[model samples]
Target: MIRLFDSAHGQVRELTLRDPGQVSMYVCGPTVYDLPHLGHGRFTLVWDVARRWFTFQGLLVHYVSNITDIDDNIITRASREGTSEELVAKTYEKSWWDAMDALGVAYPDDVPHATQYVAQMVELITQLLEGDVGYKTSDGIYFDVSRVPDYGLLAGQPLDSLRAGARVETNDEKRSPLDFVLWKNAKPGEPSWPAPFGEGRPGWHTECVVMSLELLGEGFDLHCGGFDLRFPHHENERAQAVAAGVRFAQHWDHNGWVMVGDEKMSKSLGNFTSLTDLLDKNDARAYRLLVLRSHYRSPIEVTPATIGDAERALARLDGLARRFGLVALAGHHLEVKDDFSWSGAALELYEHVAAALNEDLDTPKALAQLFEALSSANALADGGHEEEARELAVALNALFGALGLSLVSASAVVDEISQALVNERDGARTAQNWTEADRLRGELVDLGWTVEDSPSGTLIRRP
Candidate 1:
């Protein structure tokens, strides 16, 4: 069984599924308004790796991530651009998917849009009202925090304490500061959906509650998102489910944020870096490796130095792949218990990786085992143990693949002109003409090959 940190319990616990041999999960996806930031990339990669690892461990995984197509942000963007909200949502949703594809995140089994589930949301709110757990006001319908006894369960605080620290909105009709909106009343120029309550849209918190329960059924296996969502957002979702007399997610998990400096990256803070910008300038695989190098629950700093270090690490993996002629097993499943040949120290290493991953998805430790095996493979090759070295390389790469790391290098496709330039660059380096060598390297890069200096010679591969 895989153990994960349950935000609700404030502890790491085993992911016990509702159905045996299968796992169901719902992860909060992006709000379609602008290009995705690195935070978006980090959360997506975090959950993607988890889902892939679960599948690798021989469980049927049903993953659903939602797209918030109609939100205040979308409306603002639409108004700013002088375009329709639908166009704004569709355009940015495409941008979100493009970034996900570039990062190699597995497409979710279901991508439900907020606009597609307005009716279900309205139904849920109706139940809350009928149950005396919700109330309507001049501005919007709100969830009554007083209705739930343990309102701040996911916040890891007592109800009274949360109420003391809650931000008070002046001129609001909420009974308590902690009470949140179930539905936002519409404005003249905003998009509106008709319901018995009024012609307005669902609040951000309402969509996930209805969608997760509807698609995955009650008591789904897991729910995951960024740590920022743990408060208010996730707690509110949990409250709504309880108010409606339904069981919610069995386990909750949240990944840490991507920090730009000392502060978390955010658009409001003016430190937001676009995922597309990074992928265009650097290898997308480098970003994934950077994520895997750190623990999932720890905040990660993304900068040129860190990304460069990750790129160098990726170069090592690719070099090992080139040396052993290893093929990628990314899209393939491995039944590690039976499918692959396991024996001797190689088998021990594989088991170690599996054990580390099982211990609450300790990817950093698993990565350490992989690097250890890599060093062993190199040492064995140098000592002329060819068969043993190949065996170790294959096993190490298989584990890497299982973790969703690709070992396949871009195919080297050097045309005649590029080849001549590469040859010239090599000659310049040999002659110690650093200036000319740098110039030729830039030329080769422009021709679509990332050049690297190695002890053997100048190495070139597609970026």
Candidate 2:
């Protein structure tokens, strides 16, 4: 049986997927109001590892991460940015996609935007109302946690204890302090859709249940997110789904928050590091590698020095991979051995990682295994499998792929850049603009792709 950490229980729980041996997973996605950050990347890598280990164990994987387009934050950002709500959502969505691409994270099978599912959200909310689990507010609609009876089941906070967090003063129209909005009455100049709720928009919790039921179905394998989401967010979602007469998902997985310098990383706290800025200087694939070095469920405190160490470790991995001399005859499988304590320890740690991940996503322990694996791989490269390390490279890639940390080919796009420059220079030469051609050639050298002009043609290689 596959096991994953259930945030609801705060314990590793065994899981049984559909079709007797397959896992259908749905992970809660980002808010999309701002740029994706290192914290977001860490949570994504956690789920990535979950999907990968399942596949490694020969289980079919179907993954979906939702995009929340409509929200209070999105509205504020759209107004501030002087763009339409749709435009704002699209801008950040595209930026997030680009960031994920750079980080070597695999694209999900489906990424349905919440705005695109207004009808589904409306229908679900209506059904919850019919089930007596929700009530229509003066402004729009809300999920009455008092009706659910077990509203705080997932969070373990109970109804009374959570009153302070529900921000009841803000929503005086709600029937109870714990109730959450299902839909909001759209105001003038706001983005609205013609729904049963009289031209209002969907609520925050409505999207997940609707999208999950539609894509992964009521009884999907995993429902994963960050630990902070376990409260009103996931709890409300569970109530919404149950009230809609839909089957609830099996597992609830949530990663802990990332703190910086022993404080929660937050915008108000001024400790958050964004993905675009961080990745511009540090390599994304390498950063992903560093993230995978730790487990998903554990709290991470990202710092410049930590990221630098990751870059150094990634450089070592890349250097070792290049040393193997991957030949064009990449047709057969090979075995590898290691001698260094760290490298040996790292490989041996995989067993613990597998066991921990399968036990319920104990990410800290699993990450320990990854560090051990890296150590073992490093020592193996130096001692035992230095020459015959092809399999080691492949295994590292396969493992890293689960974490979405696979090293990108340095030659992949640098070739296209070279070709473009060459064409520019060759055109300049033909046009008798020899000065521009020389400048272009010099630019290529500055970018680390040495361009040598020869009798036959120009040759390009890393300087």
Candidate 3:
């Protein structure tokens, strides 16, 4: 079993699935107003790894990540650009998917768009109103935080304490400072759906509550997102479910943010580098490796030096594939333990990986074991222990693939132009022309391919 730091309980606990053999999850996804940043990349990668690991552990996983295509941000961006909100949402949503694909993040089983679930959200708000827990304000329908017991449980603060720290809003009709909007009454020229509460759109916090319960039903196994959402966002989501007498998520998980220098990397901070820009500058896998080097809950710094270090580490993994002619087992579902027959020494190393992952998904510890095994396999092969080295190499690549890190050979994806340059560089090296060889290698690099000189010859792949 995997133990995770559940935010609601504020401690490490075993993840008990609602069903015996299946795991259901809902992660708060991007709002699709602008290009995704490093912060967004971190959250998506964190949950994607969790989902991959759960499936690797022989569990049936159904993951649902929502899309807020109709948020205030989207509307603002649309109005500023003098276009329809739908156009803004559609354009940026495509950008979101492109970035995720580049980062190797898998698409969710169900990506419930906010616009697709307004009717259900209205029904949820109606239940709250009839239950006397929601009240109509001058501008919208509000959820009276007073009606929900322990409303600040996720925030770890008392109701009064939270109210004291709350930022003053313009809506004086709200019962208390802690009260949140359930539905926003429509404004002139804004998108609106007809509801019992009048023509309006649902509030930001209400979308996830309605979508998760509708798709995963009450008491889904896990609810996850970035730590920033732990506050009023997630806390408000839980309150709605409790007010409606529905058992909410059984476990809560949140990953820490990606940092730039000492401050958190965020759009509001004006420090967010576009994820697309980063992907264009380096191998997309480097970002994923950088994220895995730290614990999921610890703040990670993303900088040129860190990315460079991860790229070098990836070189070692790729070198293993090139040396032994190992094939990347990407997208193949194998009976993890049963698919491969391992030697005694290799089996022990494999157990270290499983144990580290089981103890709270300690990926850094697991990766350390992997690199150590790689070093040992290289030493054994050099010492004429070929059989043992082959077993370890095979196991290492399989585990890497299972963890969503593909160790593809450079020969697999290098274009003809890049491959021709690699061949030319090799010919120069064979003729003992060091200057020409180095120049050709630089040319290949400028064309966005990583060049490697090996015993078999030079190989090239996208960086």
Candidate 4:
């Protein structure tokens, strides 16, 4: 069985499935107001890795990540751009998915849109009001935090402490500053849905509660998002579910933020980098590798230096694939129960990787084992153990594939220009003309080819 650090429990524990041999997960997705940043990429990739690992272990996973099509940010962007909210949401949501595809993230089984569940959200608000757990304010309907005894449970704070630390609200009618909006009364020109309270829309926190319950039913296996969402966003979601007397997710997991230096990357911090921009500039697999190099709950730095290191590491994996003529095993459903026809080093590699992953998804430790195996396989091949090396190479391919990273083999046919440069660099090295060799290598790099030295000559591949 897989174990994960449950945010609710504040420690790593076994992931107990609600249904035997099955996993149900809901990850909070982007709001779709702008292009997805690196933070968005990290969370999606983290969860995607988890889903793939679960499948690799022979357990069926039903993953549902919601797209927040309507939110304050979306409304603000639509108004600023003088466009319809629908168009803005549709356009940016496409960008979000394109980036996800570039990052090799698998599509969730069901992607619930907030706009599609408005009526259900309205019904939920009505239930809360009828139960006397919610009250109406002039601007909107608010949930009374005091009514939910464990309102700040996810936040790891008592209600009184949370209230004291909460930002002072301008709305004096609110019973406590911690009380949050359940429904926002629509403005004159904004989109609105008919509710008994008034013509308005659902609040941000209310949408996920209604959709997750509607789709995954009560007490889903796991709920996950970025660490930043653990507080007001996820806490409020759980509060609403508790007030309604419905069970929410059984396990809560959150991935750490993507950092730009000491600060977390965010639009407000002005340190955010577009995930699409990074994908365009570097190998998409490099970002995944960079993410895997760190613990899921530890912040990762994504600078040129870090990305360049990851790209070089990826080239080593690709080199291994090229050496043995290994085919990619990505996108194939290979369960742990399936016979792999393995023995010796290959079997050991698989067992070590599986053990690392099963222990709280320790990807960093797993990757260290993989790299060590990569070196050992190359050494075996050098020592005339060709068959053993090939077996290990094939196993490495399968293991990386299970992590959603596909290794590229050498190009069978390089363009004449790139081939000429590679030959020139090899000749320069043979002639002991170090300056000329360095210059030629720089040119090849400038042309978007990763240059590496090989026994045959300079090996080049598209990064």
Candidate 5:
């Protein structure tokens, strides 16, 4: 039931798995040069939600997100810090993993580093050279864009008309302005692998092409990354596939960047906030809720006020769970009366929120529905329909679990108190103190537990 825009097709498309339940997905990960920012987190949250919802919908999702361990950025960082490239990659790779985990984002099923796939990339480039889709230059190997008839189809541009606002080097060897590098011969002190052509490393675009083809056989259910990648990065990836006569990604989904105070957050800007900094100020759950407020395709603006609001909302959800847990702990699901159905409402709320999540991961709408369900549950609990309220609360908690969100433990203490109340009631009945029995009933009521007197005894439920 998930529908996302395939930027390659310029249309929102339904995701259909070739096998009834097999959902294969790939997302382009970041180059490990610096810490993660809000801008870097947008597409990650998008795919993470997609994985959660796909599993919720009974699909077995295979997610692979690539890590750009070897890149020009890494090289530059190493040089600036007077450190080895391997050391730089190692440090930032761990940083990246920790940041993603703290933000309530789950790791992909497989993370293949670009450095580990050098051999595959070399093989891919060799094939391209042999196929006449690439040519050698004194500097490196470059993809001959002139070979691919539909070179610019994915980017919605014309190769011959790539003359406006271009920033890349206008090399004399390139036949057209769009003929991007497949490999670059090592400059002095830059890391390089000696190849048949020369000592050089693969280009930024080439690693992804090789990685996707090697892992997903050149065709997959969906390819995902930030909208900024739609141009040269993803477009070049598609062109390589077409030149190799292979099917590329079935659908391409791009999540927009997070704007800083006013501009798009990037490492180049001092306005960017690091994930670690955000984590130091807020718990993982609060940070997650902040990100989930907006649809992934839309631009998200990160601010202190926004995150504070997220924390308040999460607190409300946690409180509701605590209230419901107290009631459900006291009785079995089957023995509950019509008025005491917290578990039922919880499940109902879960269904609605899950459906909202599936429809393109409309997180804000899903979160709104969750808050609405919580409100009703709270009202019901406050009104003395303890069991009815418990049902709704359970649903919200389970859905929160599915989204990988965790508030503090509220379920434990509630259960303990409920058991103690039952014990106290039993003690009063044994002593035959009618006066004490009525007093205990009043005490329980005051504490949000309703005790109803019957012909046999008093029936207790969450109020």
Candidate 6:
């Protein structure tokens, strides 16, 4: 069994599945209006690791992550660029998937787009209205927080306190400051969907509740997102389910933000680095390794220094793979079942890693153990205990693979053109032509080789 810190309860609890041997989880995904930021990459990698770990432990995992294809941001971007909202959503959504692929995050079992679920969202809103927990205002339908007794449960605040601290809204039509819109009235020249409430689109909070319930059903195993979503977004989603007298998520989990200096990396902060930009500059696996090095619920900094550290750590893992001739185990599932075999040092290391992962997915602790084992395995091989070292190396490779970090073997055979470029770069450095050396390095990078400088010469390899 796995344990996670349930945000609603503010404590770590065992993950009690709705069905035996099966896990169903919903992670709130990106709203594609622009390029995804580092924060987006962090949350996605965190949940993807959790999902992979669940599967690696022999649980049948069904993962659902939703995309907000229709949002105020998408509409604004469309209007600013004089394009259709559909075109803007499609363009950025493609970019979102491209980044996900680069990060090695697995595609969800189901990706419910908000536009595709508008009809279902409307139906949910109608149910809330009939239940008298929702009210129609001048702008749109608002969910009256007053009606839901535990409206702020996920926020870890009482309703009165939440209202007291909430920012004053311009919409005086709403009965309470904490009230959230279920449907938004369409503005002129904005995208609209025909609904019973009016010709308007569904609100941001409404989409997740409706989609998660429809796809994963009531009381799914877990609902996850970034810590920022735990407040108003997740709170409102839970409120709607409570208002409608339906069970929502069984457990709530959230990962922490990516910090740039003291501020959270977000578009509004004007401090966000594009995720694609980082992927282009560094090895794609470096970001995933960075995420693993830190506890998921703790804020992480993504500076060049930290990224470079992760890259070097990955190189160390690759060195072990090269020495042992270990095959990459990524994209393959390893199940610890009844007939599974383990022995000696491999079994001992596996148990230690498993215990760490089962405890609230303590990846940092688990990784520490793995790296320590990596060192021991290298020492054993050096001491002529070849078979013992090989077994432990195989286990290490699979363990890291289970966490979605695939170790690379020795460098691939460099093409003649790339080899020539590397030689040119080496010659440039020898001749003290700094500008030419830099240009050659850039060319090699553009040719999809990770360029490094060794004592002998330029070392080029596929990342």
TM-score to native of every candidate shown: 0.89, 0.78, 0.90, 0.90, 0.81, 0.88
Write candidate 3's Cα lDDT for 313-351 as tens digits. 998898888778898764333325446775676788778
Q: Predict model 5's lDDT versus the native.
A: 0.75
Show where candidate 5 strays beyond 4 Å: 163-165, 263-272, 326-351, 410-463
- TM-score result, candidate 3: 0.90
Model 4, C-alpha of 346: deviation from truth (Å): 1.9
lDDT of 5 by residue, 379-401 (tens): 98789897777666666665665
Rank the candidate models, highest TM-score first: 4, 3, 1, 6, 5, 2
Backbone clash tally for model 5?
17
Q: Candidate 1 lDDT, tens digit per residue, 41-75?
A: 99999888888888777788899999999988899
**lDDT at position 249, candidate 4:** 95
Per candidate, the number of residue pairs that clash is 0, 12, 0, 0, 17, 0
What is candidate 6's lDDT per residue for 23-120, written digit by digit as tens? 99999998999999899999999999999889888899999999999999998899999999999999999999999988889889999999999999
Residue 201 in candidate 1, Cα distance off native in Å? 0.9
**Per-residue accuracy of model 2 over 118-209 as CA lDDT, tens digit each:** 88887887787787777787888878777766667798877877876766566667777677788888899899888765788888888888
**lDDT (CA) per prediction:** 0.88, 0.71, 0.87, 0.89, 0.75, 0.90
Per-residue CA lDDT of model 4 for 219-279, tens digit only, reads 9999999998999999999999999999999999999978788766565654439998888
Higher-ranked by TM-score: 2 or 4:
4
Report the lDDT of model 2 for residue 45.
69
Q: Which candidate model has the greater TM-score, 1 or 4?
A: 4
